[model samples]
Target: MVDVEIIEMYIPNSPSTLIYIPGITSSLTQPELYSTLHQTFSKFGLLYQVSVKNVDSEYYTYIRYYSARAASRARAAALRGEIAIKDSGPVRVTGLSRSGFPNVPLSRYKCEELANFYLGFSGWRSKVLYHRKEESDPLMVKYVSVVSLEFPRDSVSCEGAGLCEQPLASAEEEGDSYIDIITKTAKRSLGEAFLAAWGKVLLIVVEGSKVQVQINTTKEDQFLYNPVWDEPVVSVSEVEYTQDAENEDEV
Candidate 1:
């Protein structure tokens, strides 16, 4: 069946709030990938609003936020509000190497929009993060620790290898790359420039030059996101992440 888990879920104030998606490789095989695995769904039923239900066996959709394919599918999910995770979509991966790991220790009681950039990414990243120090719940600290423990640190795959590299594309597309398309949105605020506010939205993969944003629009509303004014790329740099071997026990 489609193994959908909410290991450390804390429904934010709005749909636009950042929701963490850990390793898909693990999400597929791990039962705890869902909220029930974390043992907090029924208790905190007030929080989540069932995004995706019975996903079936092989997972129907699996993709990043920067990919065009991912954007289209995720948008469809937000429409139904009950999408199946892991079929296939655009490739919009946010974090590279170990920085991408859902590396939080405590689930915060309240949803806090944390860090805006991923570690060691360069020139407009394909993703953004809620980088937090604690897990959303205190009681679940142990579970979060388990995740931290299980996160692979020095894998060759993280250093740009394996099935991971197939989804990425050029930075020259539409004057954007998988990285630029995402980092731009995560970092820039359209409202700051007297533009319309972006409501509930989901990001697909960052492929070629275009990164898709699946707006959480209603049936009557259009999924088009047009900015009257877009600020040019001023400075895009890489986020360098170096794992201190001495900090091995830090997680």
Candidate 2:
């Protein structure tokens, strides 16, 4: 039997999930600072997003966690002077609450990163199951691709398909551009499909414990369907079994 859980799309826009840290003492322009911040806060829980910005000549950072419990725990730790970055003094953490904040969808790169971070590289795999040219014309070509995502430990697999239309250029010098577009379209389709499937699988970590809650997508995220100017239709859900399962399950 397959353990199927519906990934709910509606994440309550509560302030408890958002954490604000001010006066980091590091230059906000440094790219390494963001990585260090991510590595630090992600330890408390699965982070929704982390960003640092300059405000009034001070470096301020915001850490958003998927789980409010995780946010609370991180705040408690910060209050105790346990959290610091690169010899910076103890950071101050606070919650940012607003009247009606929207739940922005995760990007394809972010989805891949989170999946790898929590599930590990070997925990999940995506394979191209099918591909075909659907239509062609003098100036354009259409192709369709089907991809399968497998999480072996959970005995779960999801299938999704993507459709794309690529424009053809008349100039021979631009042939590489056409091929590159087609290749990118196919990859985007694959990523979009994976986004829809993975979006349903929410990873929530509190303290040291982690949980995966499958939420029913109440509405199709507009972000998942269209990556670029021309939108690709994505279809999902079919299962395949893997023969061998690896034993490196540590989140």
Candidate 3:
């Protein structure tokens, strides 16, 4: 029996990698401010994203780095009057409190977005080991999917499974609806299964100019996979692994 698991991806909840810069009144445009902020903060580490926002009549910028260590260094530099976003004056940097850190849910689409940006097109790959429909009671239909993900460059791989079930049509339903029902159910099941496989907390590490995704499994609460003991009902023939640059769900 294959050890099927679920990769429950989540953003870091503590040791925040995000910093805030308030009272950033700049003569430069928003884009210029963004660029300046990127250039200024990126010197500490590779940045995940940067944004400038206006609260009331004042402007502030948020800088997010891939590494918490980098954020700490940047924060310390600002505190010591060594770093300034603009020549207007030396600015203060503030780190988000542990409870205030954002922990966004790792949806399938977001996972791919981050992966492609950080890991590049050829850095990782995924293959569907099997996607098979299960024979259950007449009132319900179920599908099971097993997939494998590999980061060839990093030499890391893991297997995950997804299971979805839908209600079967009643005998009174039109016959034509049977095909539609099956198709819709199968697509949902496959999408969910793929999400389970793609969803894992990816800790982005940056060392100067190099960046890599490190699978974060230190938090025991994030491992959310439980497998059923049933035998396989159907299996697909050799499915070749493919690299997808475009945003396409493997359904």
State the C-alpha lDDT per candidate. Answer: 0.26, 0.65, 0.65
Instruction: Tally clashing residue pairs in candidate 2.
Output: 7
User: What are the per-residue Cα lDDT tens digits for candidate 1 across 139-216?
Assistant: 221110000001122111100000001112333445766555444433322211111112222323233223233333
Q: Rank the candidates by TM-score, best first.
A: 2, 3, 1
Clash counts for all predictions? 48, 7, 0
Q: How do the residues 9-89 of candidate 2 rate in per-residue lDDT, one tens digit apiece?
A: 334356877888877776445578888889988888778778888766677887877566677889999999898777576
Candidate 2 residue pairs that clash:
6-214, 6-215, 6-216, 7-215, 7-216, 8-215, 8-216
Worst 10 residues of 2 by lDDT: 3-12
lDDT for position 94 in model 1: 30
Better of 1 and 2 by TM-score: 2
**Best TM-score goes to which candidate?**
2
Angstrom error of the Cα, residue 104, model 1: value is 24
On a 0 to 1 TM-score scale, where does candidate 2 land against the true structure? 0.65
